[model samples]
Target: MIDQLLKMADGPLQDLLSQSGMSGTESTASAIEDTFGSLLKNKAQSGDLSAIKEMFSGSDTSPQSPVIQNLAGDLSSGLMDRLGISSEQAMSLAKTALPLLMNFFNQRINEAPQANEDIMNSVVKALQGGPGSGGADILGSLLGGGKGGGMDLGGLMNMGKGLFK
Candidate 1:
């Protein structure tokens, strides 16, 4: 997931790293990617599927979204911890870059029906612990196996179909 995302980030990590005059920062990007996966996994583990569901469904990618804001904060912390970037610099980078990355996924998820398959597959994989974390049990729990009731996986896939219409 992060691998594909790395490619889609439009070099923001590289550009930001360069701007910070930070050297030997090749792994910074990787760290941020890992952090992203970890955050999603943790969110799922903690039973915050609504946010995750909303995110992949393309129903909420606004910068003001709790999911996006948390992602930004987590990424900012990773930058600060891994690269010694100031809190302000890390925040600036996160605020500047997260929207573009998230909006890319949002657009992909909300595309035409024919185009939805690949992106939805990616989303399913991501939430199925295929990329890092999230799983059938977690989703099942959301779907009545645990917490009682929510849409099924198929519904999740089709969820964005009418959101943009």
Candidate 2:
């Protein structure tokens, strides 16, 4: 899923990195993914699933929402510190990427009726430190869980694929 998001964000991420006087798209992509994953994991670990819920709930897509804004701020600060970039450059990258990520989740929720439920369930499990003890399990289960009573993992991947095209 991060791979698909990185592919979809290639052009924009490249532009952001260049503007920040940075190069190496692969590293930048990794940093973005790392920061994003960390944010979710930290929140989940702390029993604060509101952010994850908000992002995947499909109830709101506004980038200005406090939840997304807070996430962007954290991501931007992390990027600035990690990449030695100006706050403006870091914020620019965050502002751009956060919306795209949220949009991706919103799209998935809209595309699959069971997506929100499954995501919520997976997130709850992740918070309980299930399996890998992070959002990885939630994402993995959401994107790789087999067919049963809910939407298949392949269908979820297809929904994500639709975002890039």
Candidate 3:
């Protein structure tokens, strides 16, 4: 599973590695693993897994709500800028992170001795229906109702991909 994640993160992670002036090799792999492991551990301890999935995939939970879309776009852009990642790198990272992260978490969640379908279903429902549905509203409120407007995550992602090249 780690191998698969490494494969997924390879492209963007390689770019980040290069940008950070780290040479590509086993040593770099060790360093990268160390960094990612810390992040994963932190998120696992304090984060919601389904929210992470929604973040990466840009899936719409509420068709009538453009709020999530806008929120996602702003979050993506802000994160990219703050991290000094190019748009392309961010997009690729999103593309890679969501799947790789999801698989990793799903595996862990599954392997939990007491894991059950009911728990998983509840999680999925919450992701699709609860306060999670208010991502757009929460983000909008944070931005103070500025005019950046409904998130065009798909367009922004494509833009990032284009910018990278």
C-alpha TM-score for every candidate? 0.55, 0.65, 0.32
Report the CA-based lDDT of candidate 1 relative to the real structure.
Answer: 0.56
Which stretches in model 3 have alpha-carbon errors above 4 Å? Answer: 1-75, 117-165
Candidate 2: misplaced stretches above 4 Å?
A: 1-23, 113-115, 131-165
Assess the local accuracy of residue 106 in candidate 2 as a C-alpha lDDT between 0 and 100: 63
Which regions of candidate 1 deviate over 4 angstroms? 2-6, 10-28, 112-165
Candidate 2: tens digits of C-alpha lDDT, residues 1-165: 333333555566566667757668667766786787677768777788767787668675687878777888889988888878899988887887777666656665656534575656565554445554223353455534322324355755664464334
lDDT of 1 at 104: 55
How should the candidates be ordered by lDDT, best one leading? 2, 1, 3
User: In terms of TM-score, which candidate is strongest?
Assistant: 2
The 10 consecutive residues of candidate 3 with the worst lDDT sum are 130-139
Tens-place lDDT per residue, model 1, 1-55, is: 4344445454666676667775544576566656665666676656565445655
Candidate 3: give the clashing pairs. Answer: 67-136, 70-151
How accurate locally is residue 127 in candidate 3, as Cα lDDT from 0 to 100?
Answer: 29
